[model samples]
Target: MPNPADRNAMLEARRTLKMAQSPHAYVRGNTAKFYEWLAASPVSRRVPTGPAIWICGDCHLGNLGPIANGQGSVEIQIRDLDQAVIGNPAHDLIRLGLSLATAARGSDLPGVVTMRMMEEMIDGYAAAIHDPTSGVPGVESDIVRSVERAALGRRWRHLAKERLDAVEPRIPLGKKFWELSAEEREALTTLFAEKHVGAMILSLQGKPKDREVRLVDAAYWMKGCSSLGLLRYAAIVALKTRKGRWSYALVDLKEATTPIAPAAPGADMPDDDAERVVAAARHLSPYLGSRMMPVRMLDRSLFIRELTPQDLKLEVDQFSHGEAVRAARHLAFVVGTAHARQMDPATRTEWLAILEADRRGTLDTPSWLWESIVSLSGSHEAGYLDHCRRYALAA
Candidate 1:
């Protein structure tokens, strides 16, 4: 978290340094720029607008991962809902294409491989749109398999070790977790005292519904690249599991800001930012949505969710040609199913036809998808370089 003394300057410095690290990292952080280019470029006119539904406005590889539900079963889904909205599904496709293309480039894969991966991406998405009940795909790529294995074996102890560096039920004040103000602590305690909040947390533990919950520890959490300056906190809540034992769970409280990702024109959305996020999340990712609660604290709109050990983001730094292609298809299928669930049979068929109509001879993918990725790749490379230079000068 940014120090209250110089919050903006500190946050800007941290965000600039993180984004300057790599092109893929920059793509993940610079979502506003991606939308700006899409809106202003001539390609925007050629893009087909699909049915208005809840979409992950930032559908990058990093945003899609293994998310666990109340029962602790994990599945590949969109893990972040901070930028979700009801909008054209095409925006998600373009954003995901840019993400995979950048990841391929960062891995030093051949340009031909990147082209083939895009085709497979479309194929994977179309397959799910044809059958929404396919659910999460079987693990095919090595990177995905590795992450899946880790997620399956994780428990509360694993989460504690990683997040707190100990098995004790407390958030250690350190780099990732900082000390909070007195007022902030009091507000969080009051927020957790509500019956609804306790029920949500206890839902994961299989404990008595009426069990009393206590605020064990909390801190200002400095997490994520894009949401660096936003109000975020890591809270530990404890409930007595039986007469002699207590159970603990980690809860994440993040402020909901107005999304930079634009919604479809005249789309019906909740006026409250937190409500909009939770509602869109329920449509886009059920496991996560079922665990989320919208709340107001310290006069700010915020959403709280339990952080399970099974919720792990895919950390794909390097990829072989085969892994790149397989990953493209698998992750796209995940996003496709999310979108397909929101469409009727007729709407799915119509959108699928529109997607296929732009393909030319010998090319399996849509021409506009290919063109958008090519244009955005070049633009982001330039943007990434300029960002590094600016950071260097500032340093």
Candidate 2:
């Protein structure tokens, strides 16, 4: 039996309700369950365990987006690192394929379209791994174009309004932002005062190393699906400028928990959860990792980073047949680029060769990928319906 107190029951109930809404939602919110099923499936054995590289364990559509680097340039990359680990890159590929296939089903596209998407996905990934210096293939989807344009035009005022509910500097404690406890507030105050934390804040704005950092306001953040019950907080900090002006930065502090996704058998990774997340982020998402620092707060490990307005999630609520094909190729290239960076030249060549071989009678996609998505999609649909039935009964 599970310990009820280990998790917040009310929040778990809310998570269940969110998962029951649709198959895509279920896939996004139930990564742990996905890993459990993957372990028990025969397809897991057939997929070659490529080089042990840091991988985004939950490489779904929603988690891939535009992230602005410290230099103020934005590019599409993996945005979430909660489940990151040094593992077989194949897991990320399959997870991403599962996500895209589920979205196609939600869009009511025929099964043939998904097959094509998988083939295109492999093509995009292989292209990146083979030629590391090549630019990402252009995607002509309107959604992609619009998101890029919006990210480029974002500024501090835009982030203030979206996160703080206003253009002012203080975080409002209500609805999305709950009031922090006494202990949490004190921990946050001390955290910002630390030398390393102050350096991280200044690293983003290119401020002087001696500049003072102050915690202006903070709140218990009520966000994310799978991470709902975890300790998450948003802090507003001000960096004093030489001209006596104050610039504010929004910092996200999230507790690092043990990953449900299995790492490669002999993979060497940090034992500390916070350190593990930071290490993986540094390898896979330089834009986000460069601005992040791991710290201890209230005796628990946490990862803290400054959030920029240009950091936006790729939202694919609906997709046309053409859009679906283009998205799969483009997003797979993004994930592949992350993985390819950590691989040596020899390893990259070997991995690409393995992926290209054995295309299962003109399908032009690895047989394991096709089989895995078909199986996982069916399993997730059944699980989604079962979840809805239970939720309805509980209510």
| lDDT leader | 1
**What ranges in model 1 sit over 4 Å off?**
1-5, 136-139, 361-363
Local distance difference test, per candidate? 0.88, 0.87
lDDT of 1 by residue, 209-249 (tens): 88989899999877876555578889999888768577888
Query: Roughly what TM-score does model 1 have, to 2 decimal places?
Result: 0.97
Top of the candidates by TM-score: 1
- Candidate 1 — worst ten consecutive residues by lDDT sum? 1-10
lDDT, residue 248, candidate 1: 84
lDDT of 2 at 113: 96
Candidate 2 collision pairs: none
